[model samples]
Target chain A: MLVELEDVSKRYQLGNLWVDALRGINLTIERGEFLAVKGPSGSGKSTLLNILSALDHCDSGSVEIEGINLSALNEHQCSLFRRRHIGIVFQSFNLIPVLTALENVIYPLTLSGTVNAKARAEKALEAVGLEQLMSQRPTQLSGGQMQRVAIARAIVSQPNLILADEPTANLDSVTSESIMSLMKQLNREQGVTFVIATHDNYVTGLASRVITVRDGELVEDEPSPPFTLQEAIA
Target chain B: MGLGWKVALLNIMRNGRRSLITLAAIVFGCTSLIVFGGFVQSMYDGMRESMIRSQLGHIQIYANGYNQYGKAEPEKYLIPDRDLSTISQLIESESNALVVAPRLNFNGLLSDGKQSIAITGIGIDAEKEVMLSSAIRIVDGEDLFPEDIEAAHLGEGLFNALDVQVGDYLTLLASTQDGAINAVDVQVMGVISTGVKALDDRLLRVNLPLAQELLYTSDITRMVVLLDETQLTDTAISTLVSAFEQHHLDLELKSWEELAGYYHQVVGLFNGVFEFITVIVLIIVALSISNTMLMAVMERTRELGTIRAMGGTPRQVVSLILLESVFLGLIGSLLGLLMGALAAKGITYAEWMMPRPPGSTQDYPIRVFVVPDILFRTFLLGFAISLVSSLYPAVKASRLPVVKALRFT
Candidate 1:
C-alpha cells in the first residue's frame, strides 16, 4: 500500500459551531493505482486529499504514506518528506509567477537538492509536450499550457504519489480531457500512483477505481470501466 | 547566483517604485551623515590650526608652578636666564622644533600721561613670532622692529579706547619685584588684531628688554615652542620631557589642546548635536525600509506559501528577504558616498563664508573635508540599519502557516 487512512476524522470551528470536515473515513491505495475521489460540494473530498498529502492534520486517525506515519513527522520533516515522496497539483495552476516554465518545473527538484535539475526538468516538460514553451512565464502561457507546466513540476522529482485537488476545475472540457489523458499516460508509463479529487466526470470516468464521499463520510467505493480521451469525449 | 538571491533580485524588481523609494531614503540618510561629518571635521581642523598659530604654540614649556601662580605674582616663578638658553638648545636638538621663543607676561597701567587704563602685556621675540604665527594681522602700521625696545604694538581695541595713534608715546607702570613702582616710556609702533575679544580689549606687545626693565626683572615666564606640523606635538612634548629629566631641569610641557579650553568645549557640543541627528536619521530610514519590506512580505504571502509547499525551509525564506535588503543597502551606500564626495568638493570650491560665531570677531570660510574613515562609518551604519529593518518582516514571512497562506487571495 502506498497510502493508508484508518478511521480518519477532522473537524473545524466555524464561528461558534464545530463542523466535521471528515468523519470516520477508512481508505487504502496501493502503488501504481489511478484512483479518483468524487463528491459534490461540501463533501469532505478536499479535506481527505489535504490529509493524505500531509498538508493538514487528521484529528484522530492514522494517515501513513509508504509505512511512515504522517502525524509522527514534525513540520520541517513533513516538508522534506513531501519534497522527497509526494507531489501536488492545484486547480489554479500554482506555478511561481516570477519563474519561467522550465524554472518552475525544476523548483521541486531544486528543493530536494538534486543536481542536473535543469536537464531533468527539460525532460519532464518534453514529456508533457511543452518543450517549446519551457522558457515562457505562467502569465504568457495559456490555461492548458500552465496546467501542463504544473504537471511537469509535480512529476519532475519522480515522487511515488501525486495528489491533485480539482486539477481540471479551471479548464474547459477539451483542455480538461487532455490533462487527464496526460496524467493517465504518466501513470501507465512511469508507474506513479495518483489520487485526484474532483467533481468532473471527465476525471472520475478515467479512474480505475472511484471513492464517493458525502457529508464527510465515504458512502461508496467501486471500480469503473477503463477510460481513454477518445472514449470520454465521443 | 543561488536561488535565494535570484528570487530576491526578481522580487525587488517586481515592486520597482517601492524599492526605489526605500533605496532613496537610505541614500539620503547616508549622504547627510557624510556631508555633516565632513563639515564638523573641517571646523575642528580649522579651529585647531588657528588657535595654534594665534597664541598657543605646539607646546609650551614653563617652570613647575607658573601655570598655578604666575598670574598672581608674575616675577616669583620665572625661568632663570641661564636655564632658558640651555632648554632652548635641548629642544632644538631633540625634536623637530621650528621656533623656540621666550616670553614674559606682565600686567600694568598704560597712559598717554593724561589718561591711564588697566592693561595686560606680553613681551615677545617679535621677529621669531612673526615667523611662527601666520594668524597675526596688523591692521594699521608696520610691525615693531626686533631691536626697538621703545616700540610697542597696541591692540585695535586698546588703541581706540586710549584715543591714540601710531608714534604716540605711552607710559607703562607696574609693581617691581621688590614692591616698588617702576614705569617705562614707549612709542606705539602698530595696531594689531588677534580676533579674540578678551585679548584685543586691553592687550599690548613689547620687546623682552623693556618688559624686564619695566618690571625690574631679568627673569622670563615661559618658552613657546613651534613644530613643523601639529601632528608632531606629542612627539615634541615627549622628547622635551625626556630631555628635561636628563638635564635635571625643573620644567613641564603643555600641548595646545590642553591650553585651549574653548576648543574642546566646542568640539564636545558639536559632537553631541551630530550624534543626535544621526540617531534621528537612522530611525527615519529604518522605519521607511521596514514599511516597504512589510508591504512586500504581505503581498507575497501566497507566493511564499507556494515556495514552502515546494520544500523551501523557513530559514531559506528569511534569507531571501534579508539578501534583498543587503543588495539595497550596498547599492544605496555606494551611490551616496559618491554623491557626498562630489558635494563636499563643490561646497569647498564655492568658498562660502559663514557668519562669525558668538564672541568671535571674523567670519570663517566654510570648508568640507571628506575623510575616508567617516565615509566608511556612514556606509556601515546605513547597511546595518537596513539589515535590522528587514529582520522583522523576514521573520513574519517565514512564520506564515502554509495552508492559510496558500488559501490567501
Candidate 2:
C-alpha cells in the first residue's frame, strides 16, 4: 500500500462551536494510482488532504505512508518526511513572487539537498512545457502557466506521492483542460501517484479512481470513466 | 550566500521604501553615538593637556612627608639642593623625559610702594618653566630670563591690583626659614594669564635665586618632570622609582592623574552622559527595527507558509528574518560612520568657538576628533541592537501555523 488511513477523525473550533471536519475515515491507496477526492464545500475534502500531506494531524486513529506511521512522527520529523517523499500543489500556485519560475521549481530540490538541482528543475519545467518561461516571475505568467510551474515544482524532486488541492479552480475551462492533460500525462509516463482534492466534475472524470466525501464521511469509491470536453461543458 | 540569505536580501530590496525608513533610523542612532562620543573624547583630551601644561607636569616628585607635613613645617619637608640635583639628574637620564624643573612654593606680601596685597609665589628655573607652562598666555612684556635675577612675572589680575605696569619695581617680603623676615626688590618683566580667575588674581613668578635669597634657603619644594608623551608616564615612573630605590632616596611620586582632581570629575560626568545617550539610542533603534521586521513578517505570511510547506524548518525561517536585520544593521552603521566622520572634519575645519567653561575666564575653540575606537564600538552597538531587536519578530514568524498561514489573505 502506498497510503493507509484507519479510523481517522478531525475537529476544528469556530467561535466556540466545534465542527467535525472528518469522521472515522478508512481508506487505502496503491502505488501509481491517480486518485481524485470529490466533495462539496465544508465536506472535509481539504481537511482530509491536509492530513494526507502531513500538514495537519488527525484527532484519532492512524495514517501510514509506505508503511511509515505518519501519526507517530513529530512536527520536525513530519517536515523531513514531507521534504523527502511528498510533493504538494496548492490552489493558488504559491510561487515565490521574487523568484523566477526556474528558481521556484528549484526550491524543493534545494531544500532536499539534491545535486544538480538546476538541471533537474529545467527538466521538470520542460516536462510541463514551461522551459520557455523559466526566467519569468509569477507576476508575468498567466494563471494556467503559473499552475504549470507549480506542478513542475511539485514533481521536480521525484517524490513517491503528490497531493494537489483544488489545482485547477482558478483557471478557465480551456486552460484547465491543458493543466489536467499535463498531470494525466505525467502520471502515465512517470508513474507518480497523485491524490487531488477538488469539487470540479471534470477533474473527477479524468481520475483513474474517484472517491466521494459528504458531511465528513466517505460515500462512494469506484473507477472513473473516460471524460471528454464536450461532456464537461454539457 | 545561502537560500535564506538570498531570500532575505530580495525581500529587503522588494520593499525598498520601508527598508529605507528602517535604515534611516539605524543611521541616525549610529551617527548620534559616534558624533557625541567623539565630542566627549575631544573634550577629555583638551582638558587633560590643559591641566598638564598649566600647573601639573607629567609627574611630580616630592621629598618624604611633603604632602602630609609640608604646609605646617615648610622647612622640615623641603628637598635640599643636593637631593634636587641628584633627582633631576636621574630623571633627565630617561629617554622619554623632556624636562626636569625644580620649583619652590611660597606666600608673602607684595608692595608697589603705596599698596600691598597678599600673594602666592612660584620660584622656577626660568628656561624650564617656559617649557612646562606653555598653556599660560603672556599678555604683557616678555617671560622672565635667567640672567635677570631680580625680575618677576606678575599675573594680569595681580598687576592690575598693584597698579604696576611691566618694568615697574616692587618689593616682595616673606618669613625666612629661621623665623626672620626678609625682603627683596624686583622688576616686573611680564603679565601672564592662566585662564583661571582665582589663580591669576594672586599669582607671582620669580627666578629661583631671588626666591631662595628672600626665603633664606637653598632648598626646593618639588621637582616637576615632563615627558615626551603622556602615554609613557607609567614607564617613566617605573624607571625613576627603580633609580630611587637603588640610591635609597626618600621621595614620593604623583602622576598627573592623581594631582588633577577637577579633570577626573569632568571625565566622570561626560562618561555618565555618554552612557545614558547610548541607552536611549539603543532603545529607539531596537524599536524601529522590531516594527519593521514585524511588518515584513505580516506581509509575507502566505509566502512563509509556502516555504514551510516546501519543507523549510522553523529554524530556517528564523535565520532568514535575522539575516535581513543583520544586513540592514551592517549597511546602516557603515553609512552612519561615514557621515559622522565627515561632519567631524567639517566642524573642526570651521573652527567654532565654545563659550567659557566653569572656572575658566576665556573662550576656547571647539574641535571634534574622529576616534577609531569610538567608531568601532558604535558600529558594533548598532549591529547588536539590530540583531536583538529582530529576535522577537523572527521567532513569531517561525511559530506561525502553516495551515492558517496558507489560508491567510
Candidate 3:
C-alpha cells in the first residue's frame, strides 16, 4: 500500500458551532493507481486530500504514507517529506506570478536540492507538451497553458504521488479533456500514483479506480469502467 | 543569488510604486541625518577655530597658583621677565610650535580728559600678537606695530565711549606693583572687535613695554603657544611637560578646549539635538518599511501558501521576506548617500549666511562639511532599521497556516 488511512477524523470550528470536515474514514491506495475522489461540495473531498498531502493534520487516528506515520512528523518535517515525495496541483493553478513557467517548474526541484534542476524542469514541461512556453509568465499564457505549466511543476521532481484538487475546474471542456489526457498519459506511461479530488464526471471516467465521498465518509471504492479517450470526449 | 532571493527581488519589482514609496522614506531619513550632522560638525569646527585664534592659542602656560589666586592679586602671581625667556625657549624647541606670545593682563581706568571708563587691558607682544590674534577684527585704523611703544588698540565699544579717533591720546591709570598709583598717555592706533559684546565694551590693547611702564612692573601673566596644527596640541603639550620637569619649572598648562567652556556647551547641545532627530527618523523609516512589507505579505497570501505546499520551509519563507527588505535597505542607503553628498556640496556652494548666534556680535556664512564618519553611520542606521522593521512581518508571513492561506482571496 502506498497510502493507508485508519479511522481518521478532522473537525473545524464554524463560529459558535463545531463542524466535522472528515469522520472515521478508512481507505488504502496502492502504488501506480490513478484514483479519482468524487464528492459534492463540502463533502470532505478536500479534507481527505489535505490529510493525504500533509497540508493539514487529522484530529483523530493516524495516516501513513509508504509506511511512515504522518502524525508523528512536525510541520518542518512534513514540509521536507512533501518536498521529497508528494506533488500538489491546486484548483486555481497557483503559479508564482513573479516566476516564469520554467522557474515555477524548477521550484520544487530546487527545494528538494535536486541536481540539474533546469534540465529536469525542461523535460517535465516537454512531457506536458509545453516545452516552447517555458520562458513565458503565467499572465502571458492561456488558462489551459497555465494548467499544463502547473502539471509540469507537479511532476518535475518525479514524486511518489501527485494530489490534484479540482485541477481542471476553471478550464473549458476541450481544455479539460486535454489536461485529463495529459495526466492519464503520465500515470499510464510512468506508473505515477495519483489521487485527484474533483467534481467532474469526465475526470472520474479517465481514472483507473474511482471513490466517492459524502458527508465526510467514504461511500464507494471501485475500479473505473474501462473507457477510451474518444468515448469520454463524446 | 538563491531561489529565495530571486523571488524576493522579483516581488519588490512587481510592486514598483509601493517599493518606491518606502524607498523614498528611507532616503529622506538618511539624507536628513547626514546633512544635519554635517552642518553641526561645521559649526563646531568654526567655533573651535575662532576660540583658538581669538583668545586661547593651542596651549596656555601660567605660573603655579596663577589660575587659582591671580585674579584677586595679579601682581603676586605674575610670571617674572626672567622665567618668561626660559619658558619661551623650551616651547620654541618643539618644531610644531608656531608662536609663543606673552600677555600681561591689567585692569584700570581710561580717560579722555572729559570722560573716563573702567577697562580691562591686555599687553601683547606686538609682532607675535599679529599671528596669535588672527581672528580679532581691526574695525578701524591700523594695528600696533613692533616699534609703536606708546600706541594702543581700543575695543570699538571702548573707543566710542571715549570719543577717540586714531592718533588721539588717552590717559591710562593703574596701581603699580608696589601699591603706588601710576599714569601714562597713549595714542590710539586701532579699534578692534572680538565678536563678543561684553568683552569688546571694556577691552584695551597696548604694546608690552608701554603696559610695563604704566604699571611700573616688568612681569607678565602668561604665555600663549600656537601650534602648526590643532591635532599637534597634545603632542606639543607632552613635550613641554617633559621640558618643564627637566628644567624643574613650576608651571601649569591648559589646552584651548579647557578654556573654551562655551564651545563644549554648544557641542553638547548640538549632539543632543542630533540624537533626537535620529530617533524620530528611525521611527518614521521603520514604520514606512513595516507597512510596505506587511502589505506585500497580505497580497501574496495565496502565493506564499503555494510555496509552503511545494516544500518551502517556514525559514525559507522568512528568508524571502527579509531578503526583500535587505535589498531595499542596501539600494536606498546608497542612493541616500549620493543625494546627501550632493546636497552638502550644493549647500556649501550656495554660501548661505546664518544670523548671529546668541551672545555673538556678527553673522557667519554656513558651510556643510561632508564628514565620512557621519555618512557611513547614517548608511548603517538606514540599513539596520530597515531590516529590523521587516522582522515582524517576515515572521508573520512565515507562520501563516497553509490551508487557510491557500483559501485566502
Candidate 4:
C-alpha cells in the first residue's frame, strides 16, 4: 500500500460551532492505481487531497504515505517528503510566471537535488511535446500548453505519486481528454500512482477505483473497471 | 553562494521599481554622509594644523606649577639648569619628536620716543623656534634668525604705530622688580604679525641672554616641542602622552587640546553633530532598504510559499531574502561612495574661500578631503545597516507557513 488513512478526523473552530471537515475516514490506496475522489464543492474532497499530498496534517488518527506517519513529520520534513515523493498539479497551473516554460519545468528538478538539470529539464519538456516552446513564457502559451507545462513540472523529477486537483477544470473537453490520455499513458509506462479529485465524470470513468463522498463523509468505495486512453483520446 | 545570489538577482529584476526606489534612498544617503564627513574632517585638519604650527607645537613642557600660575612668577616655573640640555637631547632622539626650544617670557616698558607702551618680551633661540614652528612667518619680514636673536623683532602693529624701520634703534625702559627703571637700546631687526590681535600688538622677541638680563633672571620659563605629523596618528598620540609620566620630569607635557582649549572644545562639540548626522543618514538608508525588502516579500508571497513547499527551510528562506537586500545595498552604496568621493574632492580643490570660521577670517572655507579612512568607515557602516535592517523582514518572510503563504492573495 502506498497510502492508508485510518479514522482520520479534522475539525475547525468557527466562532461558536466546531465544524468537522473530515469525519472518521478510512481508506487504502495501493501502488500504481489511478483513483478519483468524486464529491460536491464542500464534501471534503479538497481536504483529503491536501492531506494525501502532505500539504496538511490531520488532527487525529493517522495518514501513512510509503509507511511513514504523515503526522510524525514536521513542516520541513513534510515539504521534503512532498518534493521527493509527491508531485502536485494545481488548478490554476501555478507555474512561476517569471520563468519561461522550460525554466518553470526545470524548477522542480532544481528543488529535488537533480544533477545535470538542464538536460533533464529539456527531456521533460520534450516528453510534454513542448520542446519547441521551451523559451516561451506562460503568458505566450495557450491554456492547453500551459497545463502541459504544469504537468511536465509536476513529473519532472519522476516523483512516485502525483496529486492533481481538477487538473483539467480550466480546459475545453477535447483538450481535457488529451491531457487525461497523456496522464494515463505516463501511469501505465512509469507505474506512478495518481490520485485525482474532480467533479468531472469523464475522470471518474477512468479511475480503477471510484470513491464518492457526500457532506464530508465517504458514501461509497467500489472497485472500478480498468481505465484506458482509447476512450479518452476518442 | 551562487544559489542564494542568483535568486536574489532575479528577485531584484522581478521587482525593479521597488528596488530602484530603495537604491535611490541609499545612494543619496550615502553620498550626503560621505561628503559631510569628509568636509568636517578636512576642516578640522586645516584649523588644527594652522594652530599647531603658529603657536603651540603638538607638545609643550612646562614647570610643575607652570600651567596653573607659573605665568605670574616666571622664575618659579623655570626648569632646573642641569636638566635643560639633557631633556632637549632626549626629546630630539625619539621618532618624529624633535625641535625643543626654551623660552623666557618677561614684561617690560617700551618707548618709541613719541609714546610709551607696555610690552611683553619672549626670549628664544630663533633657530630652534624656526624648526619648532613656535610662530608663523608673517608677510612683511623674515622669521627670527639665530643672528637676530641678539636683537629684538618688533610686532608689525607696534612697528607701524612707532613708525620705525627694520634698522631703527629704540630705547625700551623696563621697571625692575625692585622698582628701578632699567633701560636698554634695542634694535628693531624685523616686524612680525600673528592672527591673534592682542599678541601682535604687545609682544617682542629678543635673544635669550638679552631677555634674561632685562628680566633680571637666569631661570628658564617654558619648553616648546615640535612633533612630526606622522607621530600624531590615532594610537601613537595617546601612547606618547601617557609615556610622559614615566619620564619623571618636574614638568607637564601639554598636548594640542590643553594648549588651544577653545579650539579643542569647539571641535569636540561639533563631533557629536557629525556623528549624529552620519547615523541619521544611515538610518534613512536602513529604513528604505527594510521597506523595500518587506514589499518584495509581500509581493512574492506565492513564490516564497512555492519555495517553502519545495523544501526550503525558514533559515534558508531568510538567508535568500537577506542576501538579496545586501546585494542591492552593496551595489548602491558603492556607487554612492564613489560619486560622493569625487564630489568631495572636487569641492575641496576648488579653493573656495571660507568665511571667517566663527573666530577666524571670512572665507566660506569648506574643505572636502575624501580621506580613504573616512570612506572605509562609511562603507562598513552602510553595509552593516543594510544587512541589519533586512533581518526582521527576512525572518518574517522565512517563518511564514507554506499553506498560509501559498493561500496569500
Interface RMSD for each predicted structure: 1.3, 1.0, 0.8, 2.1
Model 2 has a clash total of: 0
Chain B TM-score, model 2, reads 0.94
TM-score of 4: 0.82
Top-lDDT structure, candidate number: 3
Error of 4 at B384 (Å): 2.0
Compared with the true structure, what per-residue lDDT tens digits does model 3 show for residues B261-353?
988999999999999999999999999999999999999999999999999999888888999999999999999898888898899999999
lDDT value, candidate 3, whole model: 0.91
The TM-scores that each candidate's chain B achieves against the reference are 0.94, 0.94, 0.95, 0.78
TM-score of each: 0.92, 0.93, 0.94, 0.82
- Candidates by lDDT, descending order: 3, 2, 1, 4
Q: Candidate 1 lDDT, tens digit per residue, A1-234? A: 899899999998899999999999999988888899999898999889878877788999899999999999877887888888888888888888888999899877877679999999999999999999998989999999999999999999899999999999999999999999999999988989999999998888878789999999999998654434434654
DockQ-based CAPRI category assigned to the predicted complex of candidate 4: acceptable
Order by DockQ, highest first: 3, 2, 1, 4
Segments in model 1 whose C-alpha atoms lie over 4 Å from true places? A223-234, B111-117, B154-162, B165-169, B185-191
Per model, the share of native interface contacts recovered reads 0.39, 0.51, 0.84, 0.37
The alpha-carbon lDDT assigned to residue A137 of candidate 3 equals 92
Alpha-carbon shift of residue B351 in model 1 (angstroms): 2.1
Looking at model 2, residue A98 earns an lDDT score of 87
Evaluated at residue B99, the lDDT of candidate 4 is 70
Between candidates 2 and 3, name the one with more favorable TM-score.
Answer: 3
Give, for candidate 2 chain A, the lowest lDDT window spanning 10 residues.
A225-234
Best by TM-score: 3
